[model samples]
Target chain A: MADHEIVIAGFGGQGLLFAGKVLAYAGLLEGRELSWLPSYGPEMRGGTANCNVILSDTPVGSPIVQHPNVLVVMNAPSLDKYEPLVAPGGKIFVDSTLVTRKVERTDVDVFYVPATQMAADRGMHDLANMVLLGTVLRETGCVGEETIDEALRHVIPARKAHLFDANKAAIEAGKGYVSAA
Target chain B: MKEKVLMKGNEAIAEAAILAGCRHYFGYPITPQTEVAAYMAKKMPKIGGTFLQAESEIAAINMVYGVASTGKPSMTSSSSPGISLKCEGISYLAGADLPALIVDVQRGGPGLGGIQPSQSDYFLATRGPGHGDFHVLVFAPASVQEMADLTGRALHLAWKYRMPAMLLADGTMGQMMEPVELPEEHEAFGTDNPWAAVGTGMKRPHNIINSLELSPERLEEKNVERFERYAEIEKNECAWEEYRMEDAEICIVSYGITARISRNAIVAARAEGIKVGMIRPITLWPFPAEPLLAAADKVDSFLCVELNMGQMKDDLELAIRCRKPVDLCYRVGGMIPTSDEVLDHIRALAEGGR
Candidate 1:
C-alpha cells in the first residue's frame, strides 16, 4: 500500500476542494487513514484556493502538505508555485487548457490533460476539476476506481443529485483521455 | 462498532455538543470557527434546541450564563478576538461557579490578529480567561476525533466540577477534515445540580446564584474553596499522550495542531537515528505535569513546539520544575512551523547534546 500526499491548487470556484474531498472519501472507503485541509479564509472567497489531501496506511501526521508527491494545478500561478515543491519521482497533473506553460522538472512524470477544454467539449464546464482528478487517479492508482461512485455519493448532496451523472461522465471522459494519450 | 464519517473539526464539535445534550448555543460568528455556529443554526431548530447568533461576543456569553444558571448544558464559541470580548462574562461565570462550555478556535492574536491558526492563548486559557483566580478545564484536541470526544468530556467535567470548561483549538484543527466516530447520544452525566437556581418550587430555600460576596472574609473563603476544587481537578483530570518515549533522549512538548506536526517531525528524526519523542498535552489547564516530571528524569532535554512565541514554554519549564533544559521552537502571527523546521530543531538539540 502506497501513501500519497496530494495538493490540489486552483482558483476558488474551480472545485479543487471538492476534488480533494472526492479523493479523501475514496481513501476513507478503503479504510485508509486520511486528512483534507484547505487554504481557508478570505482567499477561499475568490482568490487562490488549495487543498492538501493525504492518504496513508498508517495514521496521518500533519495535515499540512509542505511537500506533495501528487500535485494538481488548474492554473499557471498554481503551477509556478507548486511545481518546484513536488517530491522527486513524483507526478504532476496539469490542466493544459488553463495552464499552457510546460513543466520544467525532469525528475517527475507530468500529465498534461486539457481538463477544462475536455469538460467544455462534453458540456461539463463545471466538471474540469473532476476530469483532472480522473487523470490523477488513472496515473497514480493511489486509490481504486471502484470507490469513485460511492465517494461521489458521499460528496454530492441530494439536492444536486441531478449533476451526479455528469460528474461520473466527466471522470470517465478524463480516464478515457489518459488511456488514449 | 459505530460507523465513521468525515467532518471538519469545527463541525465535529457542534455535532458532539448536540449529542452531549447541549440544547442551547449562543455564539457570534468568527472565522475559522464559523462552521460551528453554522452547523448549530441548521440543526438546533430541528432538534427543539436554541441557536442564537448573539449580537456580540459579550451578549453570547451572557446568554450561556443564563442557561448555565438553570443547570442546563450550554455553550458559546469564538475565535481569538471574539473571545477577548467575552472575557467579562467568562469572569462572571467563574465567580458564580457556573459550569459552561466555551470553545475558542484560536487565530493569531494580540489584537484582531490574522485569521490563521495559533496557540497564543495558552496563558489566557490556562491561567484564567478573565479577572479571577479561578481555572477553567482547558482541553486541547490534536485531531478531529479528539475535537468531538473532548467536547463531550469537557461538558461533563464542567458540570461535575461546577466550573467553566474550554475546548482550545486553532484554525488548522478547526478547518481540517478527518474521519471520526462521533459518540452516541446519551443523557449528560452530572446534570443534577443541587446548587442550581431553578425556581425553588415553593418547597426549598431559593437558590441564589450570585458572585457578590461583599464581606472580605466570605469572598476569601469562596476563592479558597474554588482552589480546593481546582487542586482535585489537577490531580485527577490531567490528560496527555506520549509517543516513542521509551528510549528518547529529546522530548518534544506540544499540543493541538502543533502536536500533530511535531509527531511527523519526530518520526522523520527517528528515521535519521535521533532519539526523539513527544508529550502532547490534551488537558492544557491541568498541564499534565506528572508525565513531564517523569520524562525529565529520562530525557536529556525538552523542546516546546507551539504556534505562539513560547507561551507554552513557560508551562513546560514550570511543569518539569527546570529539572532538564527546555527549548522553544515556534512560529507566530498565523504562520505554522513545518515538519522540516521542527525536525531541524530536534536535530540541533540532538547534536548539541552529542
Candidate 2:
C-alpha cells in the first residue's frame, strides 16, 4: 500500500496550508484515505506555518506526522527545522528562491526548485507554494497532474476562478525547472 | 455509499448537527473550534435556521436550553476555557432534563492554557461538567467521519434520554480534515417529547420546564429517576471498537486522537510479533466497561494511551476491577505523544519490563 506522509512548512502568507489543501483534495478525488492537519494559533498570524498531510491506501491512523516521508520547505527556517526529520531515502522539495543554505543531509533525495523566483517571473507572485507542489509531483509521481487540475477546481472558489490558469502555469514552470535540471 | 467530501472535524460536527435536524446554533468563537461556529453561521442563515453568536459561552448554552425546552434540537460549541464558562448552563440543562448538543474541542487547561490539543478535559466532561451529581452522555470521535456520525448519534441519544450530550473532541480532532459522508437530512428523532414546554392552548395543564424543586424528597426523587435512566443507557448504549483483539494479550485502551495514534503503534508492534490491540471507547460516559472488563480476563495487561496525565487510566482500572496491570502512556499540556513513544511502551510491556 502506498502511504505518503508529507509535511509542508513555510512562513505565514506563503500559501503552505493552501498547497496542503490541494494535495489533500487530490488524494480525496482519487478515493484514497487522507488527512490534513494544520498548525494553528498565534504562529499562523505572522510566524512559521506548517501542515501535515497524509495520503494512504489504507485508513489513516494518526494525522500528525512526526517523521514525514516527504517534506516541502519554502523558507530557510522551515528547511532548517524539517530537513533532518525527513525519512531516509525520502524526498525533499526545497524552494531555492527563499532558502539560501544547502541541504546537509545525504541520505535523502532533494530537489531545489526556484519556485518563488519562477512564480515572480511568470507573474504568479503568490503561487510559489503551488510551484513547489508541482516539483513534488514531478519528482515523486505521488498524484497525477490531471488530478491536481481537477483538485484546483474544487479548492479555488468560483469567485477566484480567474487565477486557475496562473496557478496551472506556475505548476508547469515548477515541473519545467525540475526537467531542465 | 454517499458521496464523500473533505471537511475539517469541526465543520463535520456542524454540518452533521444540521442534518440531525438541529436548526438552532449558539456559540462563541474559540481557537481550534471557531470553524464550527463559522460553518454554522454561513449555512444556517441560508437554511432559515437560527445561528446566533452569543455574547458569551454562558449565554450560548442558555440559548440551547431555551430551544431544547421547546422540543427542537439546539447546539453550542466551545474550546476548553469557553466550555468551562458553559458548565453552569450545562448543569441547568441537565437539571431541567433538556436535550441539547454541546461540543467541547479541548485545548490545554487549568486556566486559559495554550490553544493546542489536549485530553485533560476527560475528568471535566465525565466526572462533573458542573456542580451536580449528574452525567451528560459523552461521545469521543477519533476521525472526521466519526465526528460527523457521532454528532448525529449524540443528539439522538440525548433526546432519547432527555439529557444533554457532549462531543468531547481535542484541538487536533477539530483542526484535522478528512473525507466524510455526512448524515442525510431527516426528521429529528425523539423530538415529540410529551414534557416539552410548548404552549398548551388551553387543552391541558401547562408543561413547565424548571429544575427548581423546593422539597429535598422531590429533588432526591428526580436524581434517582435520572440515575435509573442512566443505568438503562449503560446497559444498552455502550459503544466501542475492538481491533485485532481476537487473540491479543496486550490491550490498549484509548479514545479520540490518542486512539488513532495508538492504532499506529499497535500495527507496528504487531509486525514485531507483539500481540497488541486496542479497545477504543466511543461513548466515554457509558465508559464501555463491559468490553474492558471482559478483556481483563483474556489479555495479560492493559496499556492506556492518552493525551492527559493518566485520566482514562483510572477509569480503565476501575472498569477492569484491577484484575491486571494497566500502564499509562501519555502526554499533557497540549502535547501529543508520537507513535514511536507509544511503540516503546508496548515494546517494554512485551519484554516483561515496566
Q: Which candidate has the highest lDDT of all?
A: 1
- Which parts of model 2 are misplaced by more than 4 Å? A179-181
Model 1 alpha-carbon drift over 4 Å, by segment: A179-181
Pairs of residues clashing in candidate 2: none
Q: lDDT per residue, candidate 2, A1-181, as tens digits? A: 4689999999888998999999999999999999999999988887999999999999999999988889999889998899888998888888888987888999988888888888888888999998898888887777777899999989998999999999888888877775332
B58-136 per-residue lDDT for model 1 (tens digits): 9999999999999999999999999989989999999999999999999998999899899999989998999978899
- In order, the TM-score of chain B in each prediction is 0.99, 0.98
Could you give candidate 1's per-residue lDDT for residues A1-181 as a string of tens digits? 7789999999999999999999999988998999999999987887889999999999999999988999999989999999988999999999999988899999989999999999999989989999988888888898999998899998999999889999999998888775322
lDDT of 2 at A11: 88
**lDDT per residue (tens digit) for residues B2-57 in model 2:** 99999999999999999999999999999989999999999999999999999999
- For model 1, report DockQ: 0.89
**lDDT at position B170, candidate 2:** 95
